[model samples]
Target chain A: MLARLARARTGGLAALVAVVALLPLALTNNYHYEVAIVVGLNAIVCVGLNLLIGYAGQISLGHAGFYGLGAYGSAILTVRYGWPPAAALVASTAGAAALAYLVGRPILKLRGHYLAMATLGMGIIISIVIATEDRVTGGPDGMAVAPFAVLGFTLAGERVWYWVIGAALALAVWLSLNLIDSPAGRALRALHGSEVAAQVAGVDPARYKVLAFVISAVFAAVAGSLTAYYAGFITPAKASFLHSIELVTMVVLGGLASTFGAVIGAAVLTTLPQVLTLLKDYEMMVFGAVLMLCMIYLPRGLVPTIADALARRRR
Target chain B: MSTFTLKHFTRAALAASLAFGAAAAMAQAPIKIGAFLSVTGPAAFLGDPEQKTLELYVERINAAGGVLGRKLQLVSYDSGGDAEKARTFAKRLIEQDAVDAIVGGSTTGETMAVVPLVEQAGVPFVSLAGAVVIIEPVKKWVFKTPHTDRMACEKIFVDMQARKISKIALISGSGGFDKSMRGQCLKVAPNYKIEVLADETYGGGDTDMTAQLTKIKNTAGVQAVLNAGFGQGPAIVTKNFRQIGLTVPLYQSHGVASKEFIKLAGPAAEGVRLPAAALLVAETLPDADPQKKVVVGYKRAYEERFKQDVSTFGGHAYDGLMLVVEAMKRAGTTDKAKVRDALEGIKGFMGTAGVVNMSPADHMGLDLTAFRMLEVKNGDWALVK
Candidate 1:
């Protein structure tokens, strides 16, 4: 059973890499690459979010706040203070992690809806600050971000960004899978199943919950920094409550506790709007209907439901 | 006999070649105009009409023997008021659609997000958003249709000077437009010899401005008050100004130039003044005014076609599309650089806003004369003169 689980993990990672590598074959233009890059960035954020919401059963409605902080942090550091892009990215990600650590310890004590509301408030506050502090963040008008550079080499264009995001996504998935397979991951799952029982079984719920929150925030922050750099502009909209909700929805729709499910969910939700442009004025209506039908038909989420069906068929 | 048959075959081949050449000439590729607008989100009020205007004019232009004898193709996307999505759509427009020019950015946020992309792509982008940042310092490839908040400040201050009202109170909202306009007004007040006696601001979602208004009312030597904001905030301010019975002339920024403002503020809006495009008071314009014919024609056509009230937002789109078309006509080719040059060299072109006179220094290409001073009378907009 151990060998089979190990093999499955390797197989999933190999398949994900293969898909990322092969996706360019289908992308005939830069637009397709741009969309794919966005999908990968969202996948990276969702994978980390899945660790908290899916594995530890902690709900956060303000994860976008962390993401926004990372974006604005990097943008401000590079554009205003003239810091190196790579250092700015690392600094921003670390800052986001530190903030998540401090806030998560106190807020993660609350479960379910209270936690959700707290996170939601946190995101709204961040968004408002970004909008109000126009002198620095350019307020709601947004500010231009300096191009991403490392060692005097600039990373420009959609094709180059596609590969960067693709690699980051693969790394994110690998790390998430490894964490889930480890003892800490078991403690998280145990706590999620029953916090009282997990505590009785010698699992420190508070420590693991904060650990998950900080890790997820790091993921969101890193993705956000890359997004700001990639787009060469940053806006408060990145940290809006709506964006946080979208990230959580991607996790739920992809399936809880499944790393690849999160990735698939990100891709679908990101690309759905672009594809739905054909519907013109009816695009929103159709998009809402499609999401509703998906939820109704696949209540366990897309990946989990499909995986379950495949297992039952083998039996 | 063999020579005669060969001559007939050669003649048929020549005829076929001539027909093919004629077909190729007739099917000249269209000039593609791309756009990304916030058509279905918070800024939908600005973008929806803009989209309608583009579609309406693109069709009309094609029917009227199109620019340079080639049909105009408008490829637009709904960005849903998300700046990130707007950037993505602008990328698709530049990289995939390969449009000759871009002509939409419905809000300042969306417009500013797209500025870098269009500049890098070296595409002429005429933004419909109202912000000084879009045109200030004059980005090589960027232009805008709407008057900036700074220009609105200047126009309002000029009107105040004409009325000999130097001492004024300023009340603004915390929203981006409100803040930017307030900042601009403060910066330029000295140039017009105006003194700001009182300054107050309310939150974006604030419904009551009675306290702010009362403070302004009690300020000594306050000749007029300028409220710099849009949406329901300005209307609420107007009503509160009346409720408090402040008799000073209430000046509003161009933000509330729409008829909806009057409807919302009710009778209190009757004496309120604002600087707006001539489009709002099209019917009241003198026949000799340069923009009168153009604004009236556009207003009538838009209203007749869409069955909706003509908005300055839609007029922005009309100006954007027409400017690009006019540039293409003058350039005599769809070449990007040449068309951009033609756009900058445009002078005395009558648009919905007014006579546009673009130059290397000014990408927006409109002056104080472009904004017409108007006041609400009998619950409708009237020319201030």
Candidate 2:
């Protein structure tokens, strides 16, 4: 059974790699590439977020705050202080991780809705600060981020960005999968199943919870930094409460505790809007309906429900 | 017999050549105008009408004989006020659609986000968003239709100077437009010999400004008050100003030039003044004014078609589409480079805003005269003159 589980993990990663590599064959234009890039970035964030919400069973409504911090941090560092894009991205991601570590300890102590509210408040505060600081972040008007470059080779065009985001996404998925199979991952699952029981079983719930929070925040931050550079602009809206809710929704919709499910959730939610653009004024109405139907029918989330069906069919 | 055969053959060849030439001319591809607007989000109020105006005019122009004998095609996407989405749509417009020009960016953030993309693509972009940053330093490929917050400040200051009111108090909201306008007013107050007595700001979601107003009211030698904001905040400020019974002149930025402001503020809005596009006062403008014909025509057509009150935001889009079309006409071809040159060389062209005089140095190409001063009277907008 353990060998089968290991095979399944490797199989999922290989399948994801194949999809990313083969997606370009079907993409005939830059628009397709652009949407794919956006999907990959969102998937990277959702992967990290899945580790916390899916594996550890921690709810965060302010993960977008970490994402926004990474975006604005890189934007300000590169645009204002003239730091190299690579250095700025690394520094911003580090900054967000440090912040998540500090806040995660106390915030993670609360259970259920209290934790959600705390994260929501943190996100709102970050959004307001970004909007208010017009001198630095350019406020709500947003500021341009310099093109992402490394070793004097600037990353330009949608095709180039597609490969960059694709590789990053694959790496993120690999890391999450590895983390899930480790002892720490088991401790997180134990905490999720029952915090009191987890403590009795010799797993430190507090440390593991904080660890999950910090890791998830690092994922969001790295994705956010990449987003700013890829789009060439950053706005306070990146950190808005609405965006946080959207990210959380992607994780839940993809199926909590399932790594591949998180990725599938990100892809569907990201591409749905682009497809619904054809509906024009009725786009929002239809989008809401689709989400409702999915929740009603596939309650276990998209991936888990389908996976369960396949197992039953084989039986 | 030989002479008859030669004559008949020459006539048939002439007819075939003529038909072929006409078919080639008729088959010319339409000029594609791309746009990305926040048509269904927080900024929908701005983008919805702008979208309507573009669709209305594009159809009208095609019916009245398309520019340079080719129909205009507008490919617009709803960005929903998301800057990242706006950038993505813009890329699609440029890279996939290969449009001749772009003419929409409903919010400053959206416009600013797409500026680099448009500039890099070398496509002419006429933004409908109101911000000095869109045009300041004059990006080569970018242009905007609405008057900047800085110009609005100058126009308001000029009106204050005319009234001999030098000491003014400013109460602004914390939104991007409010802050930018407040900053601009402070920057140019010295040029107009105006002194800012009190500068107060409220949060974006603040409902009550009574405390801020009372402080301004008690300030010594305050001749007028300017509220640099838009949305419900300005209307709330106007009501609060009246509730506090401050008799000083209340000036609002062009941000809230819509009739909704008057309706929201109720009877208290009666004496409030603002600088707005000529479209708002189309009926009140003198017949001799160059913009009177264009603004009145646009306002009537838009209202007749959409069955809604005409807005300056929509007028900005009208100006944007018309400018691009006019540039195409002047250039006499759909060549992107030539159309860009023609757009820059436009002078004395009457638009909803004013007489647009685009140049390499000034992409926006509207001066203080473009903004008309108006005050609320009998619960409607009245010409300030």
Candidate 3:
């Protein structure tokens, strides 16, 4: 069983890479490349978010706060102190992980909306601090971030960014899949199914929950760092409550406990607006209708519903 | 027989060539003007008018045999007052649509978000938002039409100086615009020799600012009070200021330069002062004034078409698009570089806002003279005389 699971995980990683590689071929212009890069960044964040929310039964309404911290941390370090971009990225991700560990330990003890409200407040407080601290964060106007570079090679243009973000997203999926197939992953899933049962079965719920929270926050932080470099600017809007809700919606809209579904969710939500924008004034209306229809017909989300149908047909 | 066939073939070839030339001239593409405004969010009041003004002017310009004899094509998107959306649309406008120039941005934050993209893309961006940072430490491609926060501060201080109100209080909303305005007021207060006795701030949605007002009311030697922000926040401050019975003359930033503010604040809006563009009081301007004709004409056309009172926010869009069109006319081509150069070279171009004179050193050529101090009287704007 372990060997087969390993083989399937490898297959999933390979499939993810193949899809990402083919995505740019469909893009004919610079704008498409730009949007595709955004999709990859959002997917990286959502994949990690799905790990906690889907597999561990944890809800984070303030994931954008971690994302913002990661972005602003890298930005302030590199722009102010002139730290190397790569070093800043690592340091910021570690910082976010540490923060999540501290906050998640206590917050994870709560269940349902109580957990949701705490996370929501956490995100708002981060946003307000970033906005109000004009001296460092450049206030609401936001400060510019240095272009991403490694060992004296500057990363430029949407085409280059697409590959970078794509690779990062693939890494995120691989990591999440591996984590899900491990002992800790099983522990999280057990807790999700029945906390009392899992606790009785010798699974330390608190330790695994905090570990999952740290991992998810690190994912968000990394994605945020990449976005800051790619967009050439950063703002407190990244940490706003609306952004946090959007991230949660992406995870829920995609099938729970599925690694690939998170990617699909991010890709669809990002690209849908760009495509529907051609509809002009009816853009939001159509977007809302599409979301409503998807939920109504495919309540289990796109991936799970389709997978369930395929399994039944095979039977 | 060979000579006759050769002659017929020559005639057919000439006719085909003429048809091709005619088709090519007829296909002279319209110059694309891209805009992204906050048309559907918290800042919708600003973007709605700005978008309408762009639409209204584009139709008018095309009707009058468009600039450089090519019809203007306005491609606009609603940013919804979000920076990420603004960046995406800014990129789309520049890269995908390949618009020759852009003339939109509703809030200071949205404009700032797109500044780097526009600068990097080398697209001439004429912002409709008011912020000193947009133009200062000047960017090569970005320009703005509205007066800066610094200029507004100077205008208010100059008015306060004339009234012999040596000591004043400052309370601002915590938004980006309010912060910058507050910063400018504090920065320039010492230069004007006016003392600020108290400084306080409230959130964008805070219902009551009485606590902040009460502090200012108790502060000694406080002769005037200035509230810096846009939307209902400023109105709430006004209501709270009056309710707390602070008799000091209340001042507001140009952010609330619309009648909606008066309606929101109701009777409390009475006697408040702020600096604004002459367009707000075009009908009252003397005939000898250069801005009178232009301002009045825009007011009539906009009100007749939209059935709403003209606003300075819309006037900013009007100025932005017209400036780009004028630059295009001067350049005589749709080339981005030439349009940008021509935009910088624009001198003394009279518009509804003010007599705009663009220079390399000064993107927003209007100084403190561009702002007119007005006091609210009987629920209406009256020029401060």
Candidate 4:
């Protein structure tokens, strides 16, 4: 176990799986299970977002728009066209990936705040389209999704959903870890260090950037689809700029380059709001305070800071 | 490990034991009414009052020896105007708190999100939202207090016919509430012999609605301009319409039936009319009117407690809670099915909104008569008559 811990990926995943397996013991009721499931879903999105922002050094301010498109795409196809839910999920994910490719091709060329603004504009456009196309999207009221089923088995109850979402989150983390270690991942990191330098080193900056953008979007779309099915409802709010900001916050607060940091960030931020509800009106105030304190003390983010502390202690 | 740690641990343990003792001593559980509202979100204005109303009534009911000789307990959560939060809270309310009934849902979206859960939980739910879909295709466990958008459109159209004004221009926000009202108006316009000259839409967050208002202004033969939306969007439109110098009688949907709209639009809101609950103009209502007494009483008590003006949204919560209480009293038990049955059978229950008459077919138990056509004059709501 000590040897495995030295190699973070295998140890971190084993710990995550162990936690997921044992979490139900502490979850006394459906509400706990429900909140846990939501945490997992958010973690899945943050994991992908980390790959884009942390690994590729690209910032996306409109990731929630892709998430919304995924949700609405699957919802519309299933609820309106009567396509099977599983098939619709795949189609919507592919659609979101395709959209990210088209939108990212030009916008990803820009860096820093320009890219942020462009993504923000893209999100606003998608939100407006979803809200205005009342005939298909059900306007701002949003439409209900049919029960999520694969084959003849239906997904129901918070307990069942918790496992499903947990597995998805685990898979997202695993895939992200594998990608970060691969040659393509090296290309992304190389460009992230210096675009001009990476080009001199024969890494196609635009190609890698767009690839990361599309892959991250696909992750968001899948997460969005799962959320829609889990919630049994989808609203334009899912794709709103607020959700996009929240996704970005989770990635940054977790730690840019750490995969496990993404999961920790998603878990803390998601669960914090639920716990903060005990404070009622002061919830937002305290939530802001916590974020500020976290940034001030552990600037590298929760997981990475803790890991750094552990390594130093061992030395 | 240290003397300081030992001292603090001892203090913590003492505190926990005292709390446990206090909780255990209160053996007889109060009858819990679970509520979730958009108390601190984009729709905080709606939920804040609804939550206050529930708190106010629960206190009053408990002071009056509670319902069915048991103290009334209100368990409330702020949904923050999100559907997912509302669902999670609803589940907690039912499974964990074991609330006897629920009276909440400040927004159309929140109510819809919890409808399925309330049905499955078999709890009596009286919603404060105005969406027709909440009560329509009626779910067995749910009822609502506010007048539906359909009724609001009918009331507005009736007033238009009375004035002999037919050609109207509709400008609405692209929201669920606005879209539903627009759809209802389009479906029912022909019944009132009204022709829609042009229909325009603006995004909810859009600050300048001058473009939509400009198109409406250019449409020939447009006798009345109706804005079907809630929040500041309609106020902006009203401001722009007046700024653009369109003299046509400006009408709004019930969604904007608040003093905030008048305040937001300022002088531009003058002469603008909409159908609203009788509560808004309760003081002006004649002594002989049935709703006047109920409305005035609630308005006075609520204002005194909260130290703020009463709103129609709060009044919806007032009516919903009282209706559920009345049904429980009629049923003589807190059993979910009995309360639901009694609620369905209730009739002539005078509420602040209107005289409610629930049935198996109609869960809302109110109609067009529940809404009053009111106009803004001198920055205040006044009866259209």
TM-score: which candidate is best? 1
Q: What is the TM-score of chain A alone in each candidate?
A: 0.96, 0.97, 0.95, 0.96
For candidate 3, the TM-score is 0.92
Instruction: Tell me the lDDT of candidate 4.
Output: 0.88
Model 2 lDDT tens row, B1-385: 9989899999997876577436474457678999999898788999999999999999999999888888889899999898989988998899888898999999999999999888877998999998888888789889999888888999999999999999999999988878999999999999999999999999888989999999999999999999999778999999999999999999998989888898899999998999998888899889988788898899899989989999988999999999999998899876778888999999988888888999999998999899999999999989987
Model 4, span B1-385: residue lDDT tens: 6999999999997876577436443334588899999998688988999999889999999999998878899889988888888888998899888889998888777888888888887999998877777877989999999888888888999999898899999999876788898898899999889999999989878999999888988889999988889778998998999998999899998887777788899998899999988888889998999888899999999999989999888998999889989998999978789999999999999998899999999999897889999988888988877
For every candidate, what share of the true interface contacts is present? 0.75, 0.83, 0.64, 0.56
- Local error of candidate 4 at residue A26 (angstroms): 2.2
DockQ of each: 0.65, 0.61, 0.53, 0.64
Model 1 docking category: medium
Model 4 is docked with a DockQ of 0.64
In model 1, the runs with Cα more than 4 Å from the true position are A1-7, B1-27
Candidate 2 residue runs with Cα over 4 Å from true position = A1-7, B1-28, B242-245
Model 1 steric clash pairs: A134-A139
Count of clashes, each model? 1, 1, 0, 0
Indicate whether candidate 3 or candidate 4 has the larger DockQ: 4
- DockQ order of candidates, top first: 1, 4, 2, 3
DockQ score for candidate 1: 0.65
Order the numbered candidates by TM-score, best leading: 1, 2, 3, 4
Chain B TM-score, candidates in order: 0.91, 0.91, 0.88, 0.88
